[model samples]
Target: MPVLSLAPRRSGFGTELLTQTVPYQLRGTTTLTFKPGGLQCTIELPAKELLQ
Candidate 1:
């Protein structure tokens, strides 16, 4: 399993700041399968990122 961290953005007083906590949105499907070694893990990136 992989851990992800995100931070939100805050804006006020003509200044912008990043929040300590943010929300995460998964872009792909998650499937679990048993393997001889153990378990397999896979994650897909969002389409928006690909454009960049």
Candidate 2:
């Protein structure tokens, strides 16, 4: 299966972002620009190594 995308959930106020794996359906490969909690980071990871 191909790599899909990463949807990092934004934690509540004063809560630090948890480091966890968010699974998604493999549909080829797609790159998305995500900005959570006013912070931005690149979510580029291979499907086989989607683990954190």
Candidate 3:
């Protein structure tokens, strides 16, 4: 298993940018469904499901 994080990295000119270690938008479609007791999410993903 691999570890996932959301920290920005320093780029040229001292600018901060998100690392592309994992796909955040998930094919540009990130969906989240919330219910009374639980929640549901839908994202077009790859072979590995990245979760915290």
Best by lDDT: 2
Ranking by TM-score: 1, 3, 2
Whole-model lDDT, model 3: 0.38
The parts of candidate 3 lying over 4 Å away from their true place are 1-26, 46-52
Candidate 1 residue 19 C-alpha distance from true site, Å: 26
Count backbone clashes in candidate 3: 0
User: Looking at model 1, how many pairs of residues clash?
Assistant: 0
State the lDDT of candidate 2 residue by residue for 1-52, as single tens digits.
Answer: 4343554465553222222332243222333344443434344446665453
Error of 3 at 42 (Å): 0.4
What are the per-residue Cα lDDT tens digits for candidate 1 across 3-39? 3333214344322111111113434444434455554
Which one is best on TM-score? Answer: 1
Give lDDT tens digits, candidate 3, residues 1-52: 4333432243443121112322454423434454454435454556454352
Worst 10-residue lDDT window for candidate 1 reads 14-23
| TM-score of candidate 2 on Cα atoms, chains taken together | 0.21
Clashes of each: 0, 0, 0
